[model samples]
Target: MKTYLQAFDLWEIVNVGIEPPMLRPNPTLAQMRQHNEECAKKTQGDVLPTKQCFRHDLYKNHGL
Candidate 1:
């Protein structure tokens, strides 16, 4: 058998309507290619599967 005591806490019951900031809009195809090139240069490695893949990864990470 289990016995429990119940207490009400306003803070716990309240819903704080906090909204997350808007994400940056999707980048154009050209911007994506440029970003890929920049990333490749920064990493000092060639981009595989074309620049689009790199941009896709970046966009996903940034929540775009």
Candidate 2:
């Protein structure tokens, strides 16, 4: 078994670890801003504000 393992090529093992390039580039800052605006419009006034939602007393009582 040791001899068989030694016979395998090290370069082939290293080459297999390489990752492929991304097919699409990342979204720009403008795209991120547009997405945030859309989400805010959808959720506005329907969801609790972060400050209220994350209050320690609210979590302690509500177990959320």
Candidate 3:
């Protein structure tokens, strides 16, 4: 019983102590250029540049 409990603890530690790194997809050059153009068009008429505006534009177009 004691050995079983130790094994359980070790299992818990191994499972919980480390997390796998998250992977993200990299955009291609054309996709990046398109995104930049979209952002520019969205923000073109604005007098001040802001992150909120850029993000809003991005989300408005991309639904993200």
* Index of the highest-lDDT prediction: 3
Where is model 2 more than 4 Å wrong at Cα? 1-25, 47-64
In model 2, the Cα lDDT at residue 64 comes to 69
Compute the lDDT of residue 3 as modeled in candidate 1: 10
lDDT of 3 by residue, 8-31 (tens): 333233546754232347978887
Candidate 2 yields a Cα-based lDDT of: 0.48
Clashes of each: 0, 0, 0
Question: What lDDT does candidate 3 reach at residue 27?
Answer: 75
Q: Write the per-residue lDDT of candidate 1 for residues 2-46, one digit (tens) a residue.
A: 011001112212334433233358978887676555534533332
| Clash pairs (backbone) in predicted model 3 | none
Which structure is stronger by TM-score: 1 or 2? Answer: 2
TM-score of each: 0.30, 0.33, 0.32
Q: Please, what are the lDDT tens digits per residue for candidate 2 over residues 1-64?
A: 3223223322223446644222346878887667556545544443345446558678899986
lDDT of each: 0.43, 0.48, 0.50
The candidate 2 region of ten consecutive residues with least summed lDDT is 2-11
Model 3 weakest lDDT span, ten residues long = 2-11
